[model samples]
Target: MRKLLGACSLDVFARVDPLELIAPAPQGAALALYVNLLAESLHAAGRTARAQANGNSYGETVGELALGLAFELGARQGDWDAFCTALAAEHARAPAFWRQAGGEALLRKKVNDMFAVLRDKVDADNYQVACGRPCSPNRLYAYRMLDTAYGEIARLFAGWREHTAQVGAILGRPVDFSVPIEVRQLQSVAACRPEWIMRWSESLERFGGAPGPLHTKSKRFESLKNSPDKIADMLREIAEYEAISSNRDSGWLHDQDTAGAWIEDYWRVLDESAHGATPGPDLILEARTEELDAPMVEVAQAAPVADDDPLDAVRAQAVSLPPGFLSAARATQDPGSWAGRMLEDDSLPVRLAVYLKLLGAEDDCYPDAWRDPSTGALPNMQQLAALDAVSLPTLRKRRDAAIARLEAAPRTGG
Candidate 1:
């Protein structure tokens, strides 16, 4: 793991103000700095990984970091073309800065600042989406600070003999000639006591002549200053994720094959199915319909059927649907709408299913009747597939085809 700081220097702690860090950058240059810094970091990490005789841990770390930042960037909803144009503008403004001495570190810091803010924004949005709760960016920064504090404390604990006074202050005890049992027993951040964290924050002023994050006179962590329980919860969350990530990294399946091995499996399955080793190209199974209670809708076929046709009854028996599905579909239909007219040949349920796939399960435009009663959202792909009496893959193919048609369709009016 890379240390946040080279040594335990609390005084030199970087402030977590994204606005201030980005204030110096030109209006359109932030994204450019982020991209260049990421490329540079990845290149450096690659070289370091190659130079190391033991393992590629450095490269792995950098790759994971880049992946995370990329995810945040992707989650953002904006004009990407504007961002690209802004990046070009920034380069034009700083042609000399790109080749100047010490410019690399400055640019890297700017990139870090951009990501720091972006991470909090992305996480805040995710938290809202997942939990239906509000999470401020400052709160996320506090969580980061707490995690950093735990890491620093862990580092200090590992070398207690050299930093006896600091460690003793953190433990709220005097240093003696004998080794402290707390230092010996502390194996991970999970084992670190809540009281130890409070004490560490309190003791920072005595040693470093500066207040710690929690003890600082700032409103950023004000809510966390007095709540050790909250701090403990945050620390535990960090430890839990660390443990989970570490376990996943060392899993046996990771060594089974290269990342592209799944492509081979995909092709093999397709080949087998094509050769008639599997039941059908559609992979539909009648047994899967047993779980549903209502008859399925045949959306793929648009041929008109007689009201009392015997074939209709036989087709209805092939698949099942949830109770009241047909009524809900009927209630939500709008024949004059663009979607309704375009998909007029398909049943209302199938039209809703396509809309559900295109626009997510929950959308402002979706009628309450279209939502699954159990979830208060649109039915999932499996449920939609079951409604149509087709396999999941078949539903996906149909949905994608519908999307393609919509994209190709010409617009009439503004």
Candidate 2:
């Protein structure tokens, strides 16, 4: 809702570069459009001025980051020279390109595309950053589509009384729109079955003189027709995400220091990816694997009574410690609880490997927990591998394997 620039000169943004500024990742066209939308808002100041001129009218100001993103996109998609030329030519109207035939249409399409992608990317990142889990761009798209389906179902439910016959056709029975809808009744995505969605779409033609969303040939929602379980999973994910998102401090995107810190995180993730770090397993595949391996759980538990369970003390220590990174250095006083926990995990090599993965080879926060008490600095992989008496490959393998198990374990609820 924050307007990026009220009335700034175009020269101020001449140096913007859209692609380079974006969070480093394999983003798609949607994200590009989102960045460009911010740029478009800058050029269309007359509209904002007019809205403000008309007293008591509501208006939305694009955020500054969004504006910078737009400039980057506009510089790429729209001709900066032509736009600047047109702006210089006349102080009154929109640029020549905007007034030219088909120019507005082209710009509009580009703008729409940018915003469409941006929204999903933001939502996806919101889920990942908060959850410390991974979510792909495709998953973001799925969440949006499922959210759309949920919305359509809610609309039909709200108007069920007035269109009882049409609704009855879809519901297979029912005369109860008069009664207030309860959240419990609409808890599961299965309640809004894919067949119901298809039926609702068919019923809409007679009741509202138009086919429903899925009834169309778009194929966007076509994938939802037969995947009720997938739909249910997404429904729950989005619901949980909604709660997490609501509680998050969106102010980070606005504050300079906080936003810079976020960008650092973004860069760190990209750096890790470049270095071949894994972002955990694919959810569906992992779930399937867990199911198949469920039978071995009891056997493993029963056979684990060895006198020397390698790293049992270490594992217990690591499990009991609090959150935060641990350095190699032992505190002169009491080393931090996190450090103690990591030591207790028993396998020093695995624990050190985890430190490398999480805190990176070096972090500012590592000052207190370095391997050498003299130098409060984290050691590199080569150092950890050397300490563990194994080759780099073996250390990495053990580290990743341990982290995978830790990630898969049930938490008290992160």
The residue pairs in collision within model 1 are 294-320, 294-321
Q: Which residue segments of model 2 deviate by more than 4 Å?
A: 1-99, 131-134, 174-184, 187-198, 208-210, 249-414
Q: What tens-digit string does per-residue lDDT give for candidate 2 at 128-208?
A: 765557887667786766677677766666666665776676765665646534323665453555555556666877877
List TM-scores for all candidates, in order: 0.44, 0.39
Query: lDDT of each prediction vs. the true structure?
Result: 0.51, 0.44
Off by over 4 Å in 1: 1-110, 121-137, 249-414
| lDDT tens digits by residue: candidate 1, 1-414 | 121211111112122222222345654355333333333333234334422333222233333333334323433424323334443455567753424676445444544454556657655554443334466787667766777788788888888888899999998888887888987887887888777888888888987899987788888778778888988887776676555434432345433343223322333343345446564434433323232111122123222233242322222222222344555456446664444555677755466666654444665445555656677787665455444534333444567556555444433211
Model 2, TM vs. native:
0.39
Give the number of the best model, judged by lDDT. Answer: 1
Look at candidate 1 and tell me the lDDT of residue 348. 52
Please give the RMSD to the true structure for each candidate, in Å: 18.8, 19.5
Worst 10 residues of 2 by lDDT: 293-302
